[model samples]
Target: MSLGSAFQTLCGALFEDSMTLVCSAVVPESLTKKYRNRMISPRDPYSIYQLDSINSSYLLVFHFEDMPDCRTIQLTDMHNLNCTSHTGEEKNLYFGYSHRMCYNYTLDLTTELKHHCGARGYEENMQSGYYYTNHDPNPDIRSDVSGGSLLGSPTLVICLIVSLLLIALLHWKTSRL
Candidate 1:
C-alpha cells in the first residue's frame, strides 16, 4: 500500500478528526514532531505521519541543507502532516499559512502559476513523482535510446581531425628530440 493507506490506518486509530489524503496537504505539527526520525516499517504502521490536513494553503520545500537541488511544492487548503525522510537528515519540509488579513487566498501547488518573484516554476501535475535534478538537462524531454546515441556532426568531425593532427605533430616532434 502507498503512504496514503498507511496514513488512513494510523489516523483512524490516533485522531478523532482523521482523514486520508495524498501529499497535497500538511501533517499536523504535533504529529510531525513525535515521529521526527522514526522509520515507517510495515510491522510498525504508525511510524510514519500522514500529512492530510486540507485546512490552509501552504508551501513545502524539500532539499538538503547543503545541496543545490531544491524542489519546492505548494498546496492550497491542506492539513498538516508530520513525516520526515528515512534518514531524517536530508528531507526538510516547512508549512506556513497566509496571514494577510485582506487577502485570504491560498495558492494551489498543482496549478500552473508563477511565483511572486516572477520565476516560472509550477508543478506539472498535483501528483508526486521523481524530482528533476540539475544533473539531468531538459527533464521534460524524454528519449528511449539507451545511453543516448551520439550523432556526429561536421563540427565534431573537424574537431576530431584537428585533435589527431595536433597529436601526430606532437608525437613527431618528441621522437625527433
Candidate 2:
C-alpha cells in the first residue's frame, strides 16, 4: 500500500465509527424455536441479548458467585450484529476480543438485571463474554474509533474495502511513476 492509501485505511478506521450490540447463548431447544427469524423484544431476558460498545473478542469470560473468577464460561467469536440496544435488559454490556477467559455462568439475564437493563424480564446471557460496538449515530464525530462497528455495515464495509482498493491502486500507480 502507498502512503496515501495506508493513511486512508487508518483514517477510515479512526472515523466513520459505528456500534453493534450482538449476543449469543447456549440456548435450549425451546428458546431456539422462538429465535428462528424473530425480532425479540429487549425485555425478554430468556433470549439472546444486545447492548452497546462492550468489547470482547474470541472468548467472553463470565465470573461467578463474586468468588473472583471461581467459575467462568466461554462464548464463540463472531464479527458483530447491528441493532445496538443499550436499554432494556442489556446495558453497559462488556465484551472481549479473541483470547479472553473467566468463570461465566450462562444463566439469568432476563429474570435478573431487569432494573439494570430497564426492562422487567430481560434474559440476557450476561455470564459469558459478549463484545459490542458503539452504534449511536449521534456520537461526537471527533471521538476515536473506540466505539464503532468493526465492520459497521456489511454493505458499508464492502464499499469501504472497494474504495480503499481503488485508492491504493491509484496511489501505487502514481508512486510507481
Candidate 3:
C-alpha cells in the first residue's frame, strides 16, 4: 500500500489520550532491509521503526498523544517525523522523513499545525520512511555552540595572568642583578 493509505489507517486507529500506533504496509523487501537493524520490535514498541522481515511487508510503529482538537495528534520528534503545510493549500497536512547527521529531534511549532487534527487534507510522499540513528541524538549539544572564541574561556584568562606575573618577576630579578 502507499504511504497515504498507511496514514489513513493510522487516522482510523487513533483514539483519545496517548497511544502507540503500529501501521503496517507492503513495501519493497529492499526498503525493509535497508532499515532492518533500526526496525522497532514488539519488545520495544514505544519507539518508531520499520519491522525487519523476509517478505515485502513491514510495520511502522509511532507513539503520539491526542491533541485537544479532533483527530489531531502530536507525534514525537524522536521518530524523525517532519510535518509541513501542504504546498499551495495551507489547510492540508503534509508528512515526510528527514535525516541529518545528528539525532536532534525537537518539535517546531512552525512545522506543526493545529489544523492538522483531521486527516482530511493529509498527504505523504512515497519516499518517506522510518529513520534510525545508532548513536545518541542530543539537540542541546548543537545549540550550545554560540560561535564564541577560545580566548573567552576562564582557563585561558587565568593562564595569561600567570604568564604576565612570571615575566614581571624575571624582569625584576634581572634589574636587581
Best-fitting candidate, measured by TM-score? 3
lDDT for each residue of candidate 1 in 1-177, tens digit (9 for 90 to 100): 544344333323222322222232222344434445232111211111112343222222222122212222222222222333324433323222211111123323222111311323332322221111112223343334444343456766798999999999999999999
Q: Write the per-residue lDDT of candidate 3 for residues 1-177, one digit (tens) a residue.
A: 654445434432221122222232223344335445444332332122211221111123322211111121223333222222223221221123322121112222101211222212322211123322232244334323554755698988999999999999999999999
* Tens digits of per-residue lDDT for model 2, 82-175: 2223332322222222122221444333323323324433334433332222223343342345435556768777999999999999999999
* Top candidate by lDDT: 2
The whole-model lDDT of each prediction reads 0.30, 0.32, 0.30
TM-score of 2: 0.19
Sort the predicted structures by TM-score, highest score first: 3, 1, 2
lDDT of 3: 0.30
The model with the greater TM-score, 1 or 2, is 1
Deviating ranges (above 4 Å) for candidate 2: 1-77, 82-103, 106-113, 123-126, 132-177
Residue 122 lDDT, candidate 2, scale 0-100: 34
> What is candidate 2's CA lDDT for residue 156?
76
Off-target runs (Cα >4 Å) in candidate 3 are 1-147
